[model samples]
Target: MIDHVYISVTNIDKSLTFYSSALKPLGWKVFGNYDSASGPEGVPDLYGIGDDMYGNGKAVGSSVWLRQRKVGETGLYLGIVCDTNELVDAAYAAAIKAGGTDEGKPADRTYFAHGYYAANVADFDGNRIEFVHKAWNPKRHV
Candidate 1:
């Protein structure tokens, strides 16, 4: 239902490096890039990192773009699915190593549903992201 999500970052270069390593375990990568001059009139430079099944890297299939942060915008929250509880831990570990702040540790989140294992971490720009593995979700993605 969603094409892409644009994340405004205080620094794209730093975010790119951080995310490239952080999301690798979940099968995401920086597949596209464009400079500020390459965008429409006033758009800042964008870096694409996510599951790029659609090939655009800026749209289609989990396209996540990181651009220059705008004033007065702190951040947003996002959830990323993991294939296993182990992957959830791995993602959390990687995120922390990549400079993410620990929001919560990996553990079973029965408060949400049975078999929901997850971890929470804040990105460079303070975006709270959850890495989750939920057996309660569709079988294909879990």
Candidate 2:
């Protein structure tokens, strides 16, 4: 269970637009915005991590506000726990239509074999977020 996940981004408004459009269908609403300095420099921290990680990049139609990291950070997957696979697909589709680039398309994943379906999408910032449902099998050692 993740309380929140944070990343640096370049643009704020475009990120909000793509997320607002893509996340709407998945029943995830932007509960609030974090505009304070404690929040990330460009965009405020967003709530509703349980929704498809469909809109976790910089805002679209804007410049890449942050410098690209040479080595990508491999953080825990921000899983959305959708009610069904259809919701996952819908969120992914909507995100792409709203200016998100495909990190990966919707599909059944083997790792989360217990009925997990998910897809990965990038915001304008190039951060990777995944839309997932029923797809987690964490081992104790892991």
Candidate 3:
């Protein structure tokens, strides 16, 4: 299990808006913010965005941190799970409207498995992000 993941972006504000919009359709929202100066020991300052009260009514700390840095070529790709195919489509649209570059349009990825709906987009800083909806377990939808 991962507690959190952080990525560096050229513009924090732009990346924040991009991510916030992209993930909103999946029921995620920006919930916390952190300043590097105020962050604990080795952690960098970041904008914490995600559904905090996801499981057991306790924060799982599963969030994306947007940190300021110089823009450069990166191979980082972040994958987020969506509960429904509709959410995947909405996320792709939101990402594009939020200034993301469309890498792959929403479609069924039968190679991955049956009912695997997904879309990919590059964030403001060119980080590839994917939204996927797998119909493996219907009970997991939230």
Candidate 4:
């Protein structure tokens, strides 16, 4: 029921480094890129950038990208589904090491109650990404 999600970033290189490493364990990969494209027309416009968003003679500014199909975005969460809470914790730790600012430490949400461990990580643009495990919160309405 969803097509794609777009996020704005201040630094594509840094965002790339952080996301590439962080999302890898979750099975996401950079499926498309427009760093070599010419102008706004070459990039997706829904992300909200001007004609120079990519900048002239340099591909260092905003960019148009796509991630391989996985989960859907609900409201404010990224909705990651992991095999276990332990993996969630590991991913959270990896995100912190990959230049992503930690938004929350791993914890159990008894409301969901299985092993639901989740943590928030901020991208270079301050976009919040979440790492989650359903079992951590069995009462989380699974």
TM-score of each: 0.47, 0.43, 0.48, 0.39
Q: Highest lDDT: which candidate?
A: 1
Q: What are the per-residue Cα lDDT tens digits for candidate 3 across 6-119? A: 677888889999999998987778876766564325335768786644432333335677877644645565767677789889989999999999888999876544776888
- Candidate 2 lDDT over residue span 94-119, tens digit each: 98999988977888765323454778
lDDT of 1 at 94: 97
TM-score ranking of the models: 3, 1, 2, 4
Query: Where's the lowest-lDDT run of ten residues in candidate 2?
Result: 59-68
What is the TM-score of candidate 2? 0.43
Ranking by lDDT: 1, 3, 2, 4
CA RMSD for every model? 12.4, 14.2, 11.9, 17.0
Per-residue CA lDDT of candidate 1, range 15-128, in tens?
Answer: 899988888887888887766663336445778886745343233256578888788877775667676789889999999999999988999866544686878888877788
Q: Which ten residues in a row have the lowest lDDT in candidate 4?
A: 45-54
- Model 4 C-alpha RMSD to native: 17.0
Show the colliding residue pairs in model 2: 10-65, 14-59, 14-60, 15-59, 58-125, 116-134, 116-135
- Off by more than 4 A, model 3: 1-73
Question: Candidates' lDDT values, in order?
Answer: 0.72, 0.51, 0.70, 0.49
